[model samples]
Target: MSIEEDRAVQAAQDTVVRETDNGYRVLGSPEESVTHQHDIDRIPQFDVTQEMVSGSGENQEAWLTYGGNYEMHRYTTADVIGPDNVNDLEVEYDISVGSGSSMEGSPVIVPGDPTVMYQSNGPNHIKAIDARNGDVLWSYTYAVPSDVVLCCDDNNRGPAVWQDKVYMTTLDSGVVALNRYTGEEEWYTSTADHERGYSATWAPIVHDGTIYTGSAGGEYGVRGFHTAIDAETGEQKWFTRTCPEEEFVGDSINQAAGTNWMTATYDEERDVLYMPVGNPGPDFDGSVRPGPNRNTCGTLCIDAETGERLWFHQESPHDVWDYDSASPRMLIRDLEFDHRDEVRDTVVNAGKTGWAYSMDAETGQLITRSDPGVQQLNMFSMIPHIDDGRRGTFMPGGMGGCDWHPATYNHETGLVYYKMHNNAQEAWWRFEEFEEGRKYWGGILEDETEAMPDEYNGHISSISAFDPTTGKLVWRDWIDSDTYLWGGTMSTTTGLMFAGTQNGQFIAYDAETGERLWEFDTGDAPLSSSPISWYDPDEGKQYIAIQVGGSGWLRRGKRDDRVVVFSLAE
Candidate 1:
């Protein structure tokens, strides 16, 4: 079917039956009740309309929007989970789903409500939970076939909640929006040719009324691009191609390169979206993809409304190693630079090579770069490359100086905290089948070890704290593990940074001092599940909730599939 027809079908099917005041009932969705959302069309469109971007600045309805703040700090303002009462925590509920590859989805708490949403790896199922008692409210499983090319592991990064709708991307190359309250499908659309290497694993970002998401076409014969859809109706507004649209045209061979598998940030005031693209296709070799490979392996700032590429800065141009610059583009204000003159509104991007670059959010200008203080092999080629415009010998081989897990930006102390798994990743060229929906190539190993560690064995499993205002390394705490996988950093108004580690431990660090203040072992290894904090109205206290589940990437000495909550004793 044509894309327009597909949209129309979705629009027609977006109906709901609601209970009325008297007897019969209302045969319409919430949009019929809320006049503003009524004209948004039955089908959802991705472009950020003026309506989506414009809202009452006075509507301080908790963290009701994604990115937490317009900045995407992933931090909370609740003081519920602090050092004083952390010892009085207990498990509210424990439900286990038969496991799969890497569990990388970060669970999100719906504001002013006792609910959280997360997705499971392997199967790519979106699950929502009643945070208060750990009851499954609804589970939406994207019908994923048995055989499909999934890059890392069939993992999901979680979903974006906006205006009573849950926006999610599937591993099967689909961007779908569901009714937030009923879990009914509202609108769904394909991002790329899933039959090839394109998949959607990263969470979707909703800003200024437009839903921003990209595709994971790496290793597949596909090109990368970011698309904007209308949030109310899942309609495609515009798509910005990541790679060169031209190839050997009139010839026998043709190709479209580049894929953005991670989520980007939207600067509403400037009407721009900052995105990071993954490595070039044929993962380990860049010889096939000659030239600087324009937008791959870098951060790009584009006009969110028009999908126009404004400016791009490649971190690993001609990136042969799979050092995808695809981590979250953290937004901050009043950031400091190590050897600079002034503080400014900055966006910090951490990469696989273990360096964090602070850039001017408005102009995409380079501000300063920081090394989180780790050791690794350098990728500098002693022999200069034939002037193809590719620079070699960048520090920290791909496995990452820091990876995809979301970092925390603390407003209280102006610090950004992230987890850095320190290990040497080895890279070499290899031959492989280049099918999209199937495994293409293996990623560079952090070490020569063929198997993940049997114990928590990362060189430095601690959280690295930085002065985002200045891009200076403030402190690094080592957790002593082989690798720290799928976890996120959560900063609270109470001045605490909470993190879940591979060592079956959920730890709390002083936001300013980076001191390990408290910990509780969940009795299992975990990847990508972070601690979420909120205030409980019933008990009139603050609490930290974490999903304790084991992931294949971690040192799986134990298994824990539970939602553990901690609170302070009054």
Candidate 2:
């Protein structure tokens, strides 16, 4: 079939597949054929070496790592568009990449070629686009598995590029490497069995010659682990289970689940990888799973080369609140701690428990924890009347203190900016028989007879800037919306902070004062992915790009997927 004809057929097939209940299925096998429409040899080739990614933010060229750099700072040094003229920023171009349930993946631009970029959609659909004008260069659709069970929506974070290949993890528990130039598959490796509830949704981080990733099935009673695979050959180097054998509460290690569902940060100088591990299985009731749950709900510092654990610090021990330390742990250097009266190197993490923790990079020691970033009522309150069906309300519910959204840090001001939702969620418990390969939440948060509780009303969402070293709030601005602030924040050398709201607006704030500076409506399509910035080498212009469409809470808004790029008006 012709290229256009194939796309038409694929679109029809996608429509039918999306309408199915749950909208995701397991593929027969990894050897299944995928429809391709572009010539592999004819595509342009470019080098995305480790050196390029290491020093990516130093230049005005690319946004390499998922967090813009190995430090996971999410701060870009591009200064072409400053606060003085940011109001002049206007939409440059917008292109839709078909509709999906959610658009959480951030796009990565090729180094020195601002016009070419790559991104993934909700269903693990990968696309290579011309960043100059949002034109599709090539596309690859991953085969969905028919039997996979996903607690959340079908979401793929993004991809990592190294040398000549781009790597992405699929929802079907596999990782596939594609040629950087073309969208053709170079190699596909199964990371876990989807039938056992092991899946991957975060972007893989590549360093040296290895690609590092973690699995996501903390709610399905599957044992979680972090793996390092040979980037070029797709061979397993080493695997470290997030749950240590000694800490297993049950007879089998499978009862412990400490999934690493977020992208990790690397300290190249120290050769340490800081990965945030998710919550344990049987999410609500922890009775079945005993022990301290050592490695789960914590940050694990591993030797990147050997995948050996260097140190770990649990954020929530024996957690019954479902708090997962799954947000990006940002590495900050040479910060003066006013409380300690010394300068120190630290890794900071904003956790779902509503506190920001700063720890020593050399040894996993808690330096300080900031005040609660959100409302914190009924925290750690055990569920009462498991069989009586009595309802309980808790603040900073399962959604987050700061779930999955990447926070931004500013070196000049020594402040980290992150968003928080202050909605009180209803919690209740019931005795449900344990079933393998399925969601094992022992209780339900939202029971029948109430679409949503009246107590959930008047929800407040705010973004706060806090000093990680001293654990003090610098400034904060409350967003006038009831929904969660799902998009990640980005800081610029221009002294501005950018974040998107579920209410279809991209808003900017003054980095120092938290003053609202600018706002642009995104045509009612909620911006769920983090915003990134880059300079167009050909045009000598700087632009901020973000994926818009689909809401954060289970893709509640419009599903029109589009990458919207903005720049100063010419």
Candidate 3:
């Protein structure tokens, strides 16, 4: 829609700018869109310590950190709203964020008697909601530049709450800190030059006093790097360049556009950071850069204190297919090995290469590569070495496999649950020079939905249960063969897995078995974001919340920002 059209729509008094389940619609004003809690003081003090954030998802009372508890587990100990009662789940309250974009980030529940929820929208809008009721506590929206270039949508995975402030990365390459007590801007630190195509769409992973975040825009030829900033003062502690010495493809790959866009899980035990780095510049056409790109498509183990490179693992060498290890890496604490008798801890990561790779936590070693999680056709074939420029189609395309959506590990089942895109893309290579702040891909690729291989199902996406210990796929559930499962998954101790679908159904499946136990239609919005569960002891009820509203969760759908939450039907 054009700006004039948007203004004309906004000018309409009857236009529903925001709508909640209780029929709270901002028919007149956009400022009233952010409903603040009247009894804000009754909530609690803005005091979330490092200890509380570290012990997140364990207490079953609050969800303090992303990845649940730094392991990126996305698992909750809360089992109140599980299997049997899951079918009786109904909407608790629904709050609309705005009409800008959908919700891609998880909601963080601050630890308190009556917890408050923090959510991030695609366009850098952060909101605080009263968990007890659906009252909007407060909201802080960062002013993103209209001209700034973003690799994907204007989405932030979520925010990191520590001390007295809430931290979030911006689409305009910014790290903004806001006062947790009242939605006020505390500080804004620039991570990279946004005009040069540098952005930070991932959530800032917060540690003791430092917050670690990465840069986006690998497609724009900007050199990839992650920074450590002081959580309180917004001071950059250290920055690590991906390929400072041209380590991977030697001199052939001069442009170091290996962006570390996702949030890296921290092994607080070893004081090491395991981050997944993305694809290098010019995604296709690896001829310009000869040798296999080393650190680009793999996991990088770094010293948490000093930002020093400890070890690295490259999944797809010379990743011409854009098979980036872009999915967030997780630290599996007690992973029992299938071949080796020893019970060694490993860092598990889902890849776009349609496989799950787990490496030794202390020493980065290929522990196991899970069986194919998605369809793989013409896997790793060279782009027809002909002078004539013609596009070649390939399965497990750029958007194939587990692209970006985080996987949850079930301790009971001992399997990883993640989404898979069985897609085909028509990719062609060309020689294009790196132009600053521009699309520098020496090639181009597009989704080829009309024509796919015979083995390809009619489904656009599916979810898989991968056995990380043995490198095998236990089950692949194509819940809806028609729509995509854009939203990610999260698990509970009750052996129940929670996820949302592109068809607007918030679903629950048996983690051990691929059985669809329950589902709820969340209207026209696509539930592209993952569902998070936290037990509220005050209400004596468990709540499951998800932000549903995004067009390009892979396919364009109705765009509405609604934070729909659920609990057992009273």
- Write down the lDDT that model 3 would get: 0.76
Taking the tens digit of each residue's C-alpha lDDT, what string does model 1 give over 159-229?
Answer: 77777677778666888787766566787888777766567877787875678888775655566788988
- Per-residue error (Å), model 2, residue 201: 1.1
Clashes of each: 46, 7, 2
Per-residue lDDT value at 544 in model 3:
89
* lDDT string, candidate 3, 1-570, tens digits: 222232212322223323332111223323322223234565578578888888895778888887888998899888777777788887889866644564688878886856888888665667677876666656555656645765566667888898888888877788999888776778889988887888887777898899999888887877888789998899999998876565645554556678888888888889888888989777886876777667788999888888888889998887888887888887888788858886788999888888889889988889889898877887787765335655577888888588788889887889889888877776777787777777776776766444676787666778888888898888887755444556578999999998887778787999998798998888876778878888887687888898887644335466776788887532
What TM-score does model 1 achieve against the real structure? 0.79
Model 3 ranges with Cα > 4 A deviation = 1-39, 248-254, 384-389, 479-483, 553-556
lDDT of each: 0.61, 0.77, 0.76
Q: Highest lDDT: which candidate?
A: 2
Report the lDDT of model 2 for residue 563: 84
Task: Give candidate 1 regions above 4 Å deviation.
Answer: 1-66, 97-102, 112-122, 245-257, 336-339, 381-397, 430-462, 482-484, 553-560
Each model's TM-score, in the order given?
0.79, 0.93, 0.91
* Range of the 10 consecutive residues with the lowest summed lDDT in candidate 2: 15-24
